[model samples]
Target: MVPHVLGSGPTAPPMSTPVDRARRGKEARKRLPRSEHARWLPSVDRADPVGVLERQGRDRLPELLPIRYGRMAASPFAFLRGAAAVLAADLATSPHSGLTVQLCGDAHLLNFGLYASPERTLLFDLNDFDETFPGPFEWDVKRLAASVAVAARENSHSENDVRRSALAATTAYRTQMRRLAGMGELAVWYERIDAERLLPFARTARGRRQVESTLARARRRTSLQALGKLTEVVDGRRRIIHDPPLLEPAGAADAASLRKIFSDYRSTLSEERRLLLDRYRFVDAARKVVGVGSVGTRCFIVLLTGRDANDPLFLQIKEARKSVLEEHLPSGPYVHPGRRVVVGQRLMQAAGDIFLGWMTGPQGRAYYWRQLRDMKGSAEVAAMGPRQLRRYAELCGTALARAHARSGDRIAVAAYLGGADTFDRAVTDFALAYADQTATDHAALCAAVAAGVLRAAPDV
Candidate 1:
């Protein structure tokens, strides 16, 4: 279980030494280097598994930006394609972890989405921590800020419009940080951003209706229900159908190995979890696909039946290489990167998927397993207007601050945020500036793809 957060606030200039006192963070937002090189941006830089990713990233920028998610044949999210390969690596090299909580190292715009908490409450936070680790609070905030600029540009919004939206995001982050700083440790931990609680902030009756519609969709993201839809008897044999770009399967050998590892995978879970699933017997399994950056990586789904065909469960095993954040972090080389990542997710998220666990194969690779399609969904970014985006960004910002507070020192972060707009303004400035860089990076990746330097399997 996650321990309660301890808060701290310090306002001092950096010491010239590497002593423990050197660990005390500066109060003012130091003019962070324009690029990620000067002081590391975050700590994920040191992870090696991310390096394997680095080689591929050197040329795949076009496919990872927001512009691409909206235009699949053209590219992936432009910012993601550009940023993850190198910027995340650069951010990771920085020494900011001691400043606040271990952050979701790559907390960009889309990472925040709905998930059912342990109490069945739908809330949001740094949903993807593939690169999560101890790092500066600002790095997460800045990455988020830059993403807004990129997303706005992709929408064909004017520069002024993009700037306004980006700043709104930054300011929200700063304000929310202050709110969290003022809360008691327990109060902070218990906080959540539920849909019903968000009605007041929805700018319009239409927005409220849209939010309600989203909630209705989110409520349907349960494990049993999702598997029931995805897994069915085909030709008197149980199997999952091809869901196009979304739910494709892996190779036959990989599927076989996944089946063999299910029991061993159960050994890694707690007693209660094992007992909760004792009746489940593996029925059919196959390689499945998911996520933007995680595309092309090994992902699989396992079908299990309890009493009969009507009673079913599905488990997904996703290969967990080190996050882009790991490229700069100082963690000892992880023997099982997937296990390390899943354990980190469990530690950070208030509630995790019930099937959330780890598994290893004979080849000594790690995978993070969760119930496939278990009430899993996201807001359609293409559908929201500017005001909704702003409001949603604030929610994401607040939730991110809350997530940080839980894993690290909230008092110190609050103290660092103080009662001003310094942090917010700083993030806004950094975000707009970085967006320019990401756009450039995206162009570079596109060139590489055109030149065949990077493989472009851009499936819409």
Candidate 2:
């Protein structure tokens, strides 16, 4: 069971002192000194990056594993995003603070973005949770820090800029977490990083305009828009048009099987949600390839039409596997892997997709369902200059801290971080060092593909 460092009750002790929570956090420094974070010591028995990649592809479709490998070959940042298992192994061998939170096990820069809440407001938060599980809170921060460094390096930023961006992230996390640590529980729970709050962080007119343009584009990405673009009238009925490899028709037998699974999925929803869901009639399902790491997994797009031919609802049912951190950290007390993803997502985000639920498919494969695309906007880290990247880094750090604060003892963590740059510099040092390791790993993956150990379909 996950233990709460802060005791619970109507008259809980004040967080400032509260039986020296801060003192304990400060004491943790002695056990795992901040300076030690600068090191990335891999043991002799560490898993080979290529071997791990091959093992992950075992259960995935053979045809699509090439695409997964190809995406990772694109760049070191892409490889880092896809190789969560590889990094998790390394991080598990590193020093930790023994503080645990629901982690976004793959908390790369691209994964922190804007998505619409149930109320239709776009909120910025961690958008990926496929690898989320209980582990050292530092793991998430480390991933984010390393991602920022790698991305800055990929964009050809100066070494100083890269260090600044990395430090900005950890410093923002430290500053924001300390702020949240002093707030009332409800206040912290209600806080969110919406579009309006993010504008001030834009350092230039171009950055501000980019934010506006991205928001406008996200707001336009509704179900109706997707329906118009992805469907066509065939046999006097609406059907999802095929875009081979990426989007294609599910086989007749598979579609029938999924229809039954929809009923089981409905049972997992609340009564109100079930009534709302019943308004739509299932029409068709399609296989959809998504994300760099998730390419080979079984992901499907289910179409449902409501009210009239113009009204549409698209639900993505993505396969869930054991978290990347499962081997590194203690396993969570969840029977269904899909449920684990759903619950971890809910805990880490201030709000989530309203249709979120999970079901077990044939052979007991776990899958979770949510809206296909609801005003989702991801930062083009490729285009970001040093200034824009630094601001983005700070925002992502603050966002991650808020997410961790929700699930872990904010007081203890904040106190541990304190008001110093020691931990910030240490994480930055580690991020840069790991960025080098990622480059080496990416080169190895490219070499593996070239040597025919793995096939790569870069265009796909």
Candidate 3:
């Protein structure tokens, strides 16, 4: 089925005035008070967290299931990273503000990171879009806030500090949304967080040094760097090096399948990108493991060359399944899951990879393709102190608000938030309560593994 482009159908209503939009937002408060966001008790019949995970894994590679479980079992923070489905179910049990946007679906703290924009400038924004879908704006906010709380607690921060970090994230989000709400549509559309702009927010010589180091490291993470690290001269020709289970050569059949789908994927790109892609010659591919939640999916990295071997381009093909949100919210526009991801990323991200595209692969599996690494880097959340974590949380919150403003009704959301810290405090309470729930769920997973109900391989 052809997906309907938003704001284009004949039935679409005329654009509402800012006053009307603000009034609508206030009306929603009558249905669901901003303070109600703090509520987070699991229902009596809430689904088993492990069972929810198992169901998600049924269609994934069986051999890789153990890695997924093992990674999640490592800690409560790790469990939260891999348990988007669990959180989706829990969030569905609570009422929302109905302020919809293209959610990152799994907007954990780690998911916000640094990447190169199309103009080659470094920027910070929501980088992961594997589970992108339309849903209540607060779902993404809550997930991000909860992730901050979990990470802060894992770092042994005081409970007061943990809540403070979570509150920092929510407050940044609210204030940024309100700021964007006042701007013209074009201004909001052009908004972006340049990596250079983040340095001043570090607040100390040490923190500023760390930020500089991260930006430098991200700058060095191009495909050429990946080529040196992930490939080697074999028989006088470069080929991907094998690292069993994590990075292994794709079998002959799998290699051929990727090549066959290459043209189909290219067709999805714009004419200029298609011409740009034609400059590269396919070299080699490998079956790769990625992210905590994405571990078991079919993933591959294809090496290509432009002018010569020295000019390398690496593209990743990752399987795209129905979003975890799909089961809880109303159906979205796109029938093809891969298209859903690509479109969502374009809609929400200020600048996106030029290589982003999608296609159906072998056995009707849907997959999206993009540059494997283009000066990409993520913050080292594990090493952050309380002050640093709170600052980082604020940055992530600001980025999330910019993203939400692009796709959702910013005026309404901003009006609902107002100048009060009620929504911020409410969400912080939810984050702490949900962090406790995540700990309980993590324990359940470990118990299942111990009982042989689930197998967990050692962390790779």
Pick the lDDT winner: 3
Q: Which of candidates 1 and 3 is the stronger one according to TM-score?
A: 3
Models sorted by lDDT, best on top:
3, 2, 1
Q: Is candidate 1 or candidate 3 better by lDDT?
A: 3
**How much lDDT does candidate 2 score?**
0.88
Candidate 2: tens digits of C-alpha lDDT, residues 1-460: 2222212211222455634867777787776777777887667897899999999999998998998999999999999989999988888777688766778899989998888998989999999999888777788999999999999999999999999999999999999999998898899889898877778877679778888888888888888999988889998989999998899989998799899999989988889999999999999999999999998999999999899888899999999999988866655768688998998898889998889999999888999999998988888899999998999999999999999988887777887887888889999999999999999999999999999999999978
Candidate 2 lands at a TM-score of 0.96
Candidate order, TM-score descending: 3, 2, 1
- Candidate lDDT scores, in order, read 0.62, 0.88, 0.92
Off by over 4 Å in 1: 1-54, 57-82, 92-100, 243-252, 332-335
TM-score of 3: 0.97
- Residue runs of model 3 more than 4 Å from their true location after superposition: 1-14
RMSD of each: 6.7, 3.0, 3.0
Candidate 2 positional error at 194, Å: 1.0
